[model samples]
Target chain A: MITLNIIGSGNVAQHLISVFQQTENVVLQQIFARKREAVSHLVADAEIVTNFNDLKPANVTIISVTDGAIAEVSNALPYENQLVVHTSGSMGFETLSNKNRKGVFYPLQTFSKAKAVNFKEIPICLETEKEEDFALLERLAQSISDKVFKIGAAQRQSLHVAAVFSCNFVNHLYQLGHEICEEHNVPFDILFPLIDETADKIKTLSPKEAQTGPAIRHDQKTIEKHLAFLDDENKKAIYRLLTQSIQKNNG
Target chain B: MITLNIIGSGNVAQHLISVFQQTENVVLQQIFARKREAVSHLVADAEIVTNFNDLKPANVTIISVTDGAIAEVSNALPYENQLVVHTSGSMGFETLSNKNRKGVFYPLQTFSKAKAVNFKEIPICLETEKEEDFALLERLAQSISDKVFKIGAAQRQSLHVAAVFSCNFVNHLYQLGHEICEEHNVPFDILFPLIDETADKIKTLSPKEAQTGPAIRHDQKTIEKHLAFLDDENKKAIYRLLTQSIQKNNG
Candidate 1:
């Protein structure tokens, strides 16, 4: 079994601990967090270390810290020549510079602390400075998920940008919709089937081919009518800009 | 079997025919289209009637024409006394004026002629003038779909607005991502898991609770960097507006 030491105690840390613990070929040896008390529950079976001196040696030291702290943490951490990794899609693998062997084990899925992550289903993106290290990281990822992509740091960054649009931005739009529904005193649940159907359509069709809207069709009349329904300038601006983009791009 | 006459051979009419045919107690008796050539393969069993005067008596007549022509078709149609139902969600049930038994069988889901609808799963938005007719329509709707909602035109307009944001607007945002990915030589399918995950998140958590990205965190550095990645000012404007909304709404 490969020994694992996870750093950071946010959603990614807790989720990584649970997944690693379940995998037959993996063992969670330690968990490091700035506040040891906050992450005690996460590292209950494993050793909990708050200081970089007691970072401990492991086959894999997975860092799941925030973007800004990645470089600082990597520079301070005392895992020399160990296989150091981070679960960040945007941050480069080279952030863990002290390690002779470095890589990424980024799961291309969002995590909420309370939500259970299906590690087997989530696609883990693997990247490393050395070929052997990359292969080792790939194997660890494949043990958990069938869909493991060997993506470069640049590609991962781009994919992360796309992810922001597809996941985060889309959720923001859902929030806007929920807001509109709340304002109108209409049940937000009414939109669930349609929302689900839209996602389902994209599986079989390209987003462009599956696209359905007054904006896509250039039905300015209906677009104007829908725009009239929005009281918020931000919502109106979104409607106008999206409508313009659909027209300009598709035309 | 309750015999039904479908007026108009447009998207809604064909979908309604397929749905009604699969239903236990409903049988399509006729298909009426303005042009003689409009009726095609699937409704071959149903007699095609071009002239409204040639329309035969049926338990129900579903006018699935465009919104602008709803009143025109309803007024010109010879079928009377039978439940006259129009399928436009935005149009009022009272538009089928001068007819004693008028109602609406507006399907909340967007329908395309090429797309086969699972009517059993789609929520049929039902409204009627008479109390007994509402029950009759509700029973008929329940026979084909478990999700039949009793919604007035105004409330449905609100739901339709919500649907625009959730389905149409969301799809447009996806199309933008696709365009950007294609331009950058990145496989757009890489964003599929993220898209599916975003939709799945809202199923379990509220959109506000599930919100992510630089905008929610007000990470202006990432937002500005993303904007710099795009060359188009219109897109930049959209990104700015949406980010502003995300920040404002979060507060």
Candidate 2:
């Protein structure tokens, strides 16, 4: 059985703790939080500890803390030459101190305290400093997820940036759309199917091929009408810029 | 049975024809194309007519052509005072000549020639100049879709603009993300789950409440890191602008 200890009481940490507890052939050794009470609800009180020095030795220790806290927390780990990893998409593997056999077990997904995500579908991006530690990381990742990629720091950083565009920026566009609907007193639910279909199209077709609208068709009249209709300067600027970008890319 | 004639053989017309043919109590009387062969395969040869003058009278004639062509085609319909509608989100009801009763039957979803969409889930936005025509239009719309909305010209136009933001512009962001992944030699499939989850979240949470990531958290370090990582000037500009927009919106 693969023994595991998780640090932090944030969304990622709590999610991992819940999944690992239910996973077969995996023993959740302990959970270490800055305050033991923070993670006490996630695990038995016996398995929750406040001090890093109280962390039990396990086959793998996942530091699922915030990006800024990852380095400081990793450096503070009392144990040495153990399989230690952090669940961060943007931070480099080197962020984990060399005092431990450094690795990464980043799950490429957004976690919410309210939403229950299926861990089996989430893609786990794995990296390891030592080749021997790679097998355990891969096995642990595969146990919880169907997809696992051996990604380095550079690729992970790029993936995270790309994610910012696809997830964060695209969501901002949804917010803009919602605002437009609200201004016009139209229900925002009307846009949900369209949003779902747009995302679904990218699965089968490249975003370039899936692109459609006045911009791609260069329907100047409609474009002008839409621009005249939008009152917000920020939205107008975004509309013009993205229209130009689409035309330029597809042109 | 409600008799219907469909004009134009583009993506929207083809999709409408497919759905209308399968709808109960709806008879697809004829399909008019500039070139009959363009839509002959969609329906029997007898139902496909190349000449606008040869179009038969029906309860309703749907001009499913491009935005610019809607007026021309609606004006050219041989029958007068018949219930004539165009399936365009952006076009106004007046686009149809006064010779016929005007209405709009816009399906508020993207239509692709290659992809077969489930028409039942698509929202059909309906508008009519004559209030009595509302029942027929709503009946036709409800026959093919579960969701139907009675929207006016201004509201429809606004909804179309909102759709451009939510669907078209969002797809462009996905394209940018795909490009970034290609540059990093990472398969774009890794971001699919995250993208789906982001879209799914807004269904329950408002886009503002659903927002997450560096920009929303005011993580300046990660934002700067991502901006520096992006090599394309256009992408970098979009990244910066959208980051600013998110902060401003959520702030």
Candidate 3:
């Protein structure tokens, strides 16, 4: 059985802890959190470690902390030459202290405190400094998830940026849509099916193939009408820029 | 039975014909298409009308042509004072010829020739020039869709703009994300679950509440890193503008 110790108590950390506890052949050996109460509801007091020095050696020590604190947490680990990984998409595993055998165990899925995602579907991205540590990380990843990839640091950074566009920026667009609906006294939920289908269409067709509406069509009349309809300058600018970008890319 | 005639053979027209054919208490009396081959695969030659003058009287005639052609098609209809509706989201029923009673039967979802959507879940936004024609249009809408709203012309225009942001712009973002993934040698499918969950999250939470990532947190470091990673000038500008917009709206 593979034993694991998780550090931090943020959304990612808590989610990892919960999934690990449920997955067979994996044991949550301990959890190191600065605030014990942050994870008290998730684990017993015996499994909680408030100090980094109190962390026990496990098959893998996951530093699921903030990006800024990942280096500090790795440095503070009392043990050396152990498997230390961070669950960060943007940052590389090199940020961890070199004293430990460093690797990355980033889960390529957004985690919210309220939503419990199916662990089996999440793509676990793994990176190791040494080839020897690859097997164990892959095994741990496979135990919880059906999809796993050994992506390098450079590729991971690119994937993270792509995600910012697809997930983060897409959500921002939804917010803008919501603002428009609210200002016009229309219910935002009316757009739910359209939004859902837009995301779904890409599953069967490429985004380019699935693309519709004025921007891609370059329907100047409808474009001008939409621009005139918008009252917010920021939204108007966004509409123009994205429209131009779509035309340029697809033109 | 409520007799229906659909004028046009485009994506929206074909989808409406298919759904209306399957819906109970509705008969597709005749379909007016300039090109018979466009819809002959779905319906028999006897049911198709190439000439607008050959159209028979039905309870309602749906003009599902392109936005530019809606007015022309409506004006060409041989009958007068019949219940006529167009399915263009941006344009109002006013675009229809004055000879017929005008109404809007816009299904607020994207349609592709290849993808068959669940019509029951699609929101059909209805508007009529006269209140007397409301019941027949409402009946037609409710026959195929569970979600129906009596949205006015002005409100429908706002919803159309909102849909551009939520659906069209959102899909363009997906295209950008796909480009990034292709350039990085990472399988774009790896980001599918994240995209699905992002869309799903907003169903329960407002878009503002469901927002995540660097821009929402104002993580300047990650934001800068992403901006620098984007080699395309247009993409970089988009990242900066969208980031600024998110911060401005939320802050």
lDDT digits (tens) for residues B1-251 of candidate 3: 89999999888999998888888889888998899899988884238989989998889999998788889889999998899999988998888999999999999999998999999999999999999999999999999999999999889999999999999999999999999999989999999999999999988888898888889888898899898899999999999999999999999
Model 2 error, position B94 (Å): 1.4
Writing each residue's lDDT as its tens digit, candidate 1 over B1-251 gives 67888888776677787777667778788888878677666664678888889888787888887676788888887756888898875668877857548998877776666666677788888988888888888878888887999998788777877787888878877877777777777787767777777888888899999887778767766677677777878767777888888888898
Question: For candidate 2, lDDT tens digit of each residue in B1-251?
Answer: 89999999888999988888888799999889888677777774338888889898999999998899988898888898899999988888987899999999999998888888998899999999999999999998999999998999999998999999999999999999999999989999899999999999898888888888899989898998898999899999899899999999999
Clashing pairs in 2: none
Provide per-model DockQ scores: 0.64, 0.84, 0.85
* Residues forming the 10-long window of minimal summed lDDT in candidate 3 chain B: B40-49
By TM-score rank, best first, the candidates go 3, 2, 1
TM-score for model 2? 0.96
Query: How many clashes does the backbone of model 3 have?
Result: 0
Ranked candidates (lDDT, high to low):
3, 2, 1
Error of 1 at B231 (Å): 3.3
Q: Model 3: how far is A86 from its true place, Å?
A: 0.6
lDDT of 1: 0.79
Q: Which ten residues in a row have the lowest lDDT in candidate 3 chain A?
A: A43-52
For candidate 2, write residues A1-251 as lDDT tens digits: 99888989988898998889888888998888887667777774338878888886788999998788989998888888889999888888788888889899989987776778999899999999988889999999998999898999999998999999999999899999999999999999999999999999999999999998999989999999999999999999999999999999999
